[model samples]
Target: MLRIPTLCALLTLTPLASALELKPLALYQSGYPEGTEIVSVQVSSMRVIVSNSAQGQVDILQLDPAKGLNRIARHSLVAEGMGEITSAIFHPSDDLFAVCIRNSDGLKNGRVEFRAAADGKLLNTVEIGIWPDSLAFSPKGDFVVVANEGEGYVRDGEGFRSDEGSISLIDLRAGVAAAKHSLITLPDLAGVEGATQAEHKRLVERMIDGEELKIPFGTSPEHIEPEYVTFSPDGTRAYVSLQENNAIAVVDVLQGKLDKVFGLGTVRHAADILDDGQYAPTAELFALREPDALAVSADGRYLISADEGDTDPKIAKTKAGLPSGGGRTVSVFDAVSGQLLGDTGSQLDDMAAQAGVYPDARSPNKGSEPEGVVSFDAFGKRLAVATLERADALALIDLDQPAQLKVVQVVGAGEGAGSGKLAPEGLAHVEHNGRHFLVTGLEKSGNVALFELLK
Candidate 1:
């Protein structure tokens, strides 16, 4: 049963304008044990798919805002030595959904498992590249594209061994079971025509404590790892977020190869970089916009990213010697030219502080890490919703004026008992019965929260 927490508090950042309003509906707990990470939540016309990656299980729920939410079915794949379940997405126009699983060894090839949305029956398993981090369907639903992260791993006495990251194009024209994939490998940054390394040096070297420190922009082709993938409105091209490399890869879908790769550069802002049980933007730092998620506007004019910061060991080590790290902002870019248009700066962190949910423990690291992001149309406005992993809140941003971005509202996880909406990971918005609903999978709390958008 869906239950609303009496202790939850709704913090409205901007005045209730003629914009979208988020009302807390209910929290549906999975009843899983502690550490059961609900990393992904997606809503379809039929049901809601909640991925508990920690336990290798997926829970299917029925979210009827007019009534209540209920779990209809559950699927588990918790055997030893198998790939870890990363994410799941429903087919655009079919009764099917696919789940990405990273190989347990992390260096071997990962696989994607497609299942029927009706009864959660196995459809087919397709092998892809190493560490399939995220996947998406084309605009026409004719193909399923997977971002093969291929992250580097350090073995005992062997030092670091890196894998070449690539994109896997899964053709679904024949059918789901007959689907086959082809790999699209990335080219050297210097080899891509019209691409230059100078643009990526926005924060290549910074002065700290009277010494200049150099940061890695992932200039090498092997250092590239695709974190998230998004398609254009026309499906002619796909935009991928290279988080640790602080870059983006443009893939030509028709040609089945990488078109171009460009860096996201860096951002300068004042942030709270200490875990002293206090929250204040007292330190100024220059950090990379190592975006973790990518979202394109409906019109295909803009590309949005949640600058979650770098996770690469080299980048993290360099940042450790500095003042701060992490993007802590949502950046907007030109979809066609890959140009940085605008960003939210520190507004996301400010909103969390204002709501009294700022995670001081993460201040010394990536403050309120902005991870998952999704864009959609509602209330006669173009908007983007971002998940603040550490803050346990959602940042609702207005993209109407992309350059002058605004945090219209901050839907925070209420405080006190029975409000375990922590570390929101996956997000999906849908309109049902003429009402708009936003669903989020709470990673740490093992719960799913549903919010209704009111006019």
Candidate 2:
């Protein structure tokens, strides 16, 4: 279930906002198993929780600068029967938090976990859809939405196909009751542009593995992977990112159904800037707008996305030219209509190169690879932060304007000034005590980098 649209959009630039500086606070090492990386970070009024996949648990830490970072609680996800923890979210207005764990059964099952934010006491556990990759809580703490990324490795007749992606809406009003919610699978995306059987067939027909991995036509929805989710301001609706499908799904929570699927068009790289994957200021690669993470705008009218296009190396190597997939832009879209509201263009890539932290080796495929995004307001400025995994950096963007986004800061992931550790994956904007913090979980170095956003 996929659709292909013929019309492509060309974007224009807008004025940028006044740039601000990001001050480095400190890098706290996650003292888990060796190579046990920190994948997600969530901050609350009192605690900073991180999901460590290697250790298969969530580590709670104290973020008081006077005493430095200290491990306060470590909850075992597996011990709690929740398998490996992929992500966690703190309740918007309460002293509680939720965790999304992948069930040991892999593509077959998953779970949602709840605990006290202050003490890390296990309060409840509920089963959700398969391969729950991310979690989000409504503003009033009435529900928890889980992104079940049922990956594409399941059985398809005699061969294998993708697991149909679904979203689990667990009701929090009846606290600790596992049966109070609903699970909604997305409607087949076969009608959305580029998701049709004919288009999918044309893609696989190219001999990468010696032959086209053929399947029945008109079955594109199975290729989708629900990667991330963000709720509408009132919590009545949800905007979910379908990373592999290059689309976003809208769901009406109370109605509990997959409402609409919006196709995110591809990005045309400037004259050879990214074609060869070398570090240059020319557009060489045309990437698919496969958003991995999303943040709802302050007004709830737009959906801010980090298009960290994930292209397989084996697939790219098979082509002589840059693949016709992936996009290296930070974009915004109308939430309801799914209209293109403009994007950051190549500003992020250009700035990263100027900061001397650009991953030249990774430029060809996904220049910066923005994996995580979170939005927060300070004073009057509407701001969002994205974790650039390959570049090992954090990029902040001002999102108050309608057609433009200003690059606020480029926090490096190195030993230089204003830097964090390497391979920053998950990001969160939080207030601890009275200070505003932009926290990141480093995937490669196994550390947590904290930045104080200077107003």
In terms of TM-score, the best-performing candidate is: 1
Clash statistics: count for each candidate:
0, 31
TM-score of each: 0.85, 0.84
lDDT by residue (tens digit), candidate 2, 67-94? 6556787776566454777788767667
Model 1 regions more than 4 Å off:
1-19, 34-46, 156-158, 190-218, 312-324, 414-421
Instruction: Note the Cα lDDT for every prediction shown.
Output: 0.73, 0.68
Q: lDDT of model 2 at residue 149? A: 83
lDDT of 1 by residue, 1-455 (tens): 11111222223334245457677787878897433333333434547777877788788788887665688878785555676887777777677778889888767899999988777788899999988888888877788888898774533353344577888898888998789799998876654332324333323343333554544444465566788988998998988887766778898988888888877766777777766766667676567677888889888999999988754232235434342246789999989998889898777877677666777777766788888888887878888988888888888888888778988777774342113347777777777767777787777777887778777
lDDT of 1 at 130: 88
Model 2 segments beyond 4 Å from truth? 1-19, 33-44, 65-68, 79-82, 152-158, 194-219, 271-278, 313-323, 414-421, 431-435
Error of 1 at 10 (Å): 16
